[model samples]
Target: MSTTPHPPRHEPEPGAPRDLVGVGIGPFNLSLAALAHPIPGLDTVFYEQRPRFDWHPGLLIDGTRLQVPFLADLVTLADPTSPWTFLNYLKTRDRLFPFYFAERFHIQRAEYDAYCRWVSENLPRLRFRHRVDAVRWNPGRNLFEVDHTRLGPDGEARATGRTHTRAVVLGIGTEPHVPDPLRPLVDAPDVPALHAADYLTHRDTLLAAGHVTVVGSGQSGAEVLLDLLRHRPPGRERLHWIGRTPAFAPMEYSKLGLEHFTPDYTRYFHALPEPVRDRLLAAQWQLHKGIGADTLAAVHDELYRRTLHGGWPDAHLVPGVRVRTAGRNGGRIELHLEHVQQGTRSRLTTDAVVLATGYRQRPLDRILADLDPHLRRDSRGRPRIDARHRLVLDPAISATGCAVHVQNAETHTHGVGAPDLGLAAWRSASILNTLTGREVYRLPGRTAFTTFGLDQLHPHPHPCPQTPPARHPRELTPLADGT
Candidate 1:
């Protein structure tokens, strides 16, 4: 037998048990990372394909706001009294004054993204650029066999490595889906067809042309169309925005509508049979599924402003119309349309087509491909998952002692709440409890506040020993004035 010594284990501490390996680093997984790190005896590591935090950067329109309220940040739902909460972030940044001045629960998408990065930076628990390729069950040891492909700091692929995890959480995010008609234009040279994800990156290239055509009626489509129309680079006619829907419907927003995003709704939806739940979600969450109210206002303002200019460049809402076909000819994309209501047809040739059709869930091929025969799949051919979010392994693989959990793939089972920040903290705590067979971090009011964030909300936060720094991290020393 070989006598090579292994590197130090990445466990929490000596004799600490291994818990979870989160497969993605989006806000959903990042929130889980934040909550899991504070747990004393659970060893958890989150893997991300990207080098750093990037949440829908292309969709980060200049004036777009968050869909959920600001209080629905990473840790609050799990621990309302947790220090790492968004409220605590506001306090640390000293923006609590400005934040309160706004008098709304929502925050700008940019600021929210920056806050996520700020929270991520202070926590040393996440592992970036580590993409999970596959997971297998080794039932003999009752642990998961994970194979990961990581990119080095220099942007080169490092050798694939192995890590053993008691449970695995798959948080692979969504992939952008564009219509078939526009697919040809995407690859053509100088054709300038793109998706909303590439909007900001390709703005200048698209703006160089005389006119632009933005398709789809969702938030991204509306935002890109308005931005192009309002901010014309030097000289240009108004941009053309086409829609399949009858009109641009602003997202539904109300106190009760907001509850549809809560964990309670999640449990309610999860209780229904698979097919019925899917139909209910599609009907109710349409507008709630897209942009927020503030963004609609900005788009309306721009449209109104252009109308007052008198010399309105040809822009048509063209309700009840859908694109029959799109072809690039003579340096222009010819869009043939069908008016569903009138039963008539028309065509528009434009410089470019910006598709905002949205995205689909990333596939589970590379990760679970090899073990295809040893795993159960749902009726729709997706992995059949358990309540704890673990993948039920086949008998052959079950003998190897492994269990795989999920982090992001839950639309069919858990509803849209699967990818939300609302459940991250609680989910992490649950996974930790399951893996370690004990409560790792005490929930607020579960016991008593003895740690950082929660304890501070008292007369003076925490053990009567700490106080808010005078200028927010300006002084490194402890405060004597603290109770």
Candidate 2:
């Protein structure tokens, strides 16, 4: 004789259930997001403050290709078999054959960003336009209670119900960093001082005025200045490119130099001591610094051409110069520059000033504010990160059994490769491994940053493109060798 069993009841409203929560949805956590998507019964939700995926959009200058190789794409570094690799994107567009024949080492930014969006749309786990407000440890359940505010349908603000998670990964990226001297002029009316990110939207106005002054020596400054000089009507405006460095810094991209961008190198870098790591970052900044070969060459060509057709307001390269002060002078920006090489100071009246200084990590204080007493800090007041990339909190939060893991935001405590594309896969996999408590460590020698061997996956082959090969300038050493 068999006994009858009752059917399980379901919720009538069908509301959201509690499980795992990911704080930020940048590329780092997105990589983990793709990994977590297929796991069985793993209810995971990721929150992104931005409405969509945008990586370095402001400086996606025309013909500006990626600094790293195609192998460093999102899924490629984590799962070679994944459908979202750069090679796979090319294949989907039927450009694989042409891409291989073209023999290009780098992929274009437009395509890279597009590919990331495609992956994001398919993930279905990401909650867009949502900002995490706070994370609290629930003592009774021993789980992470997360509170976030997300935009409801029709763009109106709605307070969504909270969810619980065993772990959380924070991958909030960096922001444009401005200097102290020009802080007041950030958005001043009529004065026109802005970061390079606003260059595209503000370009036409600045070009129409007359003189333009660009600050910083990194990729954005170089490219913005180059664009202004080459694109502005023949003799209308003067361009001033100033930098604190004695010379324009060329990005080091030799075969061995590029090893630092590889996972093998990042693992080795993370194993070093704190002081040694500091010394290494200072030494390698030059290797990882500044503009791409193609942009640098374009700047050189335009400069030379303009010199031949010389006149007033042609273009000026002021190296070893720093902006000491800036103010609005008769509806224009009057910048005081200290010519470091000559030990002399000079003034330049320009239509606009752009600060292209680099970005810094987004502080975790905003989201982690409520849990201040429970949070832990490292020797330098930085978040102490463990091998699994979990934040080492006070008392290690053992009684609660909750862990706060981070994704590639460990640069302050770890090293440079923390936020890079090279380690996306490895970091995601490690976090998963920790969450599952499984001994599966797929990527060899994994650290808080960098993953190895996923780019070499043989399962998915590159698809060919249908379009004709892209037209490039004369084959040059800078674009190829980059030495």
Candidate 3:
């Protein structure tokens, strides 16, 4: 390993068991850390393998904005007064007045990334460059053992450490998902095919290509196509955008329709039978998978602008098409495609391909392998996450009061809101409340005007207790003022 010294480390006291230990330091876990900071005695820490925080660095296009509003920041939705809010970051940076004048409800992606980085830099109880290797319930000690490796600047393991905690949270987040048919092309270094996750890294090479193909109709694909169309000459813009959907649909953004992302919906979804939940997930793609209306309009406007000169642009935007297979055609790429509705097959040759196919939850088996035997899986063999976000473990593990929770890894148990930023603060607060076994965050009684199910006619709102029960030594520290 290189001799470069590691950055400053923030770790819990040695030999003493912590109340909570978070496995991954993504936005979800970062939110948890921020919410846990003000509490006086909740000893907790988070770990991330990355050297620092970066939220979709490659897709931080110059003008792209977050899908949610600015209030849905790391801590604002949960506790607006928290010093770690996005507005606080702006105030500290001396940009609050300018932000007010800008009248922007949704901020740019880069600004959001900067806000998160500021939180990561100043937030206590965070350990970057620490890769968690395994998690197991140490029955002898009645605690969970978290084995992690501290890495040098170059990502080489420099030291190994074990942390003992009463509870563990896994927030490893997602990974880019490439379709099987196109995986070979994307994996081969010789081919120019790449996932949209690395769009900016090889953007110049793509712009120089004679022709480019974007293979997904989601928001990312739309953004990439719009960027390319704006850069290329009008009427000569040779681009192709295709997906399996019947049409490039806009996201469900109606006031009431958006309630699908509410906590009520999550509870209702969890109560659903496994098969019903699977079917609902399949039919609710537009709720979370479609392109944003503004993005769709921008694409249309750009294409329309190019046609004003009397000649149509040489761009083809097709749907209901899927790539059956892809291969290297000499120096170029050849894609074998089939149209489901039309029952037709064709071949297209392109100089470059951008797979905008989205992401999937990073599997937890690798890190939780040791605890697999204790985990209670669903009919589909996925971990069974309860309504409180805790993994349903064996009676032996539960009897010890040791719990394992997950973030952004419970769509099947929760709902589409599982991966949404708007729900991050709520989920984090919920996890904290569950871990402490008392109402620490004081969650909202009702978040949506629409009742998710008929059974909730008079939903008994179990808002966290105004005053936490007389705190036991093992209980967590509740927010004092109950703000």
Q: Of the candidates shown, which would achieve the greatest lDDT relative to the real structure?
A: 3
- Greater TM-score among 2 and 3 belongs to 3
Question: Which candidate has the highest TM-score of all?
Answer: 3
TM-score of 3: 0.93
Alpha-carbon RMSD to native, per candidate: 12.3, 10.9, 7.6
| Candidate 1: C-alpha lDDT | 0.70
TM value for model 2: 0.83
Task: Flag the better candidate by TM-score, 1 or 3.
Answer: 3
Q: Which regions of candidate 1 are displaced past 4 Å?
A: 1-17, 233-236, 285-287, 309-313, 395-402, 433-483
lDDT digits (tens) for residues 1-483 of candidate 1:
211212223556543335778888877777777776656555777788688888888878787777677776877766666656787777787888988888977788898898888777776657788877788765566666778888888767887877777767777878888788767777676778888988888888877777788888777777887778767732255477777776677677665555555554565566667788678767765534455566667766766666675765455555467888888778788999888878899888888788887787788777877767777887778777666666777766544444676776777777766766656776666655565666564433222222223222334344434333221223234558874
- Overall lDDT per candidate, in order of appearance: 0.70, 0.72, 0.89
| Model 3 error, position 402 (Å) | 1.4
- Candidate 2: what lDDT? 0.72
Per-residue lDDT over 1-483 for candidate 3, one digit per residue giving the tens place of the 0 to 100 score: 321112334445678899999989888999998888876568898999999999998899889999999998988888887888898888788899999999999999999999899889988778999999999888889899999999999999999999999999999999999999999997898899999999999899998999999999899999999998988988678899999999999999999989998887898899889899999999999999999999999999998887787988999999999999999989999999999999999999999999999999999999999999999999889999988899999998888778998999999989899999999999999988887887788777667889765566563434454443331223334556973
List, residue by residue over 117-143, the lDDT tens digit for candidate 2: 877876676889887878887767777
If the candidates were sorted by their lDDT against the true structure, best first, what order would they fall in? 3, 2, 1
- Each candidate's number of clashing pairs is 15, 10, 0
Kindly indicate the candidate among 1 and 2 with the higher lDDT: 2
- Candidate 3 off by > 4 Å: 1-12, 459-483
